[model samples]
Target: MVEQDSTFLLIIIALCLIFDYHAVLLPSAYNQTAISQENETRAESIEGTLIPSEVERFNMSSMDQDYIEDEMNYPPIRECSILEEFKECGTACEETCDDLRQLIICSQECVPGCFCKAGYTRETKGGCCIPTALCPLIKRSTVCGPNEEYRQCGTACPRTCNGIPEDCTQKCVDGCFCKEGFVLDLDKCIPESSCRVTEVCRENEVYRKCGSPCQEICGVQKETACTGCIEGCFCKLGYVTEEKAGICVKPEDCIPPKYVKCPGNETFTYCGSCEGSCQNQMVSCPTECGSPRCECLARNNYVRDKFGACIHISDCISK
Candidate 1:
């Protein structure tokens, strides 16, 4: 009976010791976690990552706490690898070539670390960052259009069949573009020889000094009439222009003739034969009303396109 009583007392004592041990450790652990959280909370600003408390300060005046004035010393910058600089607050997500294959959104919060300098990115984890031009281009099974290929730094303003001007102000960018001696046409790269800028116009299409966009057409209406005269091929005097295709054909060639009355841009005339298309236009022709039709005048800058359609004279191809 005594032995049993002693054993129960011993077990009670052991339980008390265990409770006291946990009670003593719980507060300590809680204080440590709270301090750590408080320190992290202090890192609100971007400039300084850590603000040292009195305990954290190494050397300080005893009587008066004059903190360490050295800014660089407080935020110790570790030695970084080549091509890296210490950023107080910067993105840690360095996109690698392999990483680009999948989409991974990175945290936007301030992350202090060594990052690659501008114009550089890592090809892989722990690898040095390099310029995109130097990076191995991701290969594609598909080929570019005819007379086109990918370039590291190609012109953003490619020359098209219309002979659009190159934008000198634009910086070089990467992409597929026409190779030398070729031009872009309808989004396809073709030999410059085949482009309309150099090719011969079809029959009845004379390379006139001026052309009119307000000329006749099968079916279409222009939003903005060609303001000034342009240089390009135009239809002869006998034929009018097909509005939609910009092709030129005889007045009788108009399909259905549903819109035979007049073009939206042109004013109908009671006297068709002498209405206009005159070199001097209205001034030369007197009003002697007769058959009705649409006509163009030189002052309006009317001319013909390659297909013999009337176009703005300014559209004429330059010699």
Candidate 2:
């Protein structure tokens, strides 16, 4: 009986030890699971702090948002009436008198329509816009006599009447008058003939004959020269007239007449007169006036003399 009691006590001690060991192991496993869950929750909170919220993503200021909202509600722009097609009015005339007339009519049709811009004006005939200050002058009939016409006073008419009418005014007038360079003679204009006649040469003296229609003196028939009316005193032979000094001088004292080059290397010194030769014969002046230029024929060349002239290649001077 004593041994049986001893064996039962030993079995009860071993079973208690095994139960305590299993209880300790179960608690350690539960602790590990709780620690892993806590670590996962902490990692999720760290990720949330790194990301930006919705308000920060747009990056727009408060004032910008208000402006955008206002723009959405704004009214649309209205079109200008001038941009629309024209609706013709029956009063519009096919032809207008002048710019002033057109402007009056156009203004009645549309307040600002067909108006010209600055520095531009409407043309009288076509009513087109043109550059500023280019309008044509308007003329009107004058009250002057049948032979006379109204002119723009001092602007168009002569300011002086050459002492014939000493009381002439500087204003516009309608009366009988003489043409330029003439004095009044009865009812017509005539050249002056009271020129002084002289035969002797004085210092810086030049001679000019009286103008045409001079009264004959001592039966010496007056002759007309190249210049009209040889009755006027003139420079003697070989002397040209000088207007400034009113005298005659050697040809060298006068400005030489302009000369031009002709074709075939010829120089044109005068018109209607030949100044050169090709083979001891007079070379004719070119037919063309003004410059009197002439060209050589295809088979010809120029030869120099007093003046140049075109000649056959066979006639050219051998160097």
Name the top TM-score candidate: 1
| Model 2 CA lDDT for position 133 | 39
Q: How well does model 1 score by local distance difference test?
A: 0.52
Residue 315 Cα positional deviation in candidate 2, in Å, after optimal superposition: 11
Error of 2 at 133 (Å): 94
Off by over 4 Å in 2: 1-232, 244-254, 257-272, 280-316
Q: What is the C-alpha RMSD of each candidate to the true structure, in Å?
A: 22.9, 41.9
* Tens-digit lDDT track of model 1 for 1-319: 4355456445544543443233211121111111123235332222433445546555556433342243323433233444555577987677764554345788878886657777666645765555544453432212467788766566767887656542244665656789899988768888889965444667656553345756544333322556666667667665666654567776545443445655433544433444222133234555333355565543476643444345565555541
Best candidate, lDDT-wise?
Answer: 1
My TM-score estimates for the predictions, one after another, are 0.29, 0.19
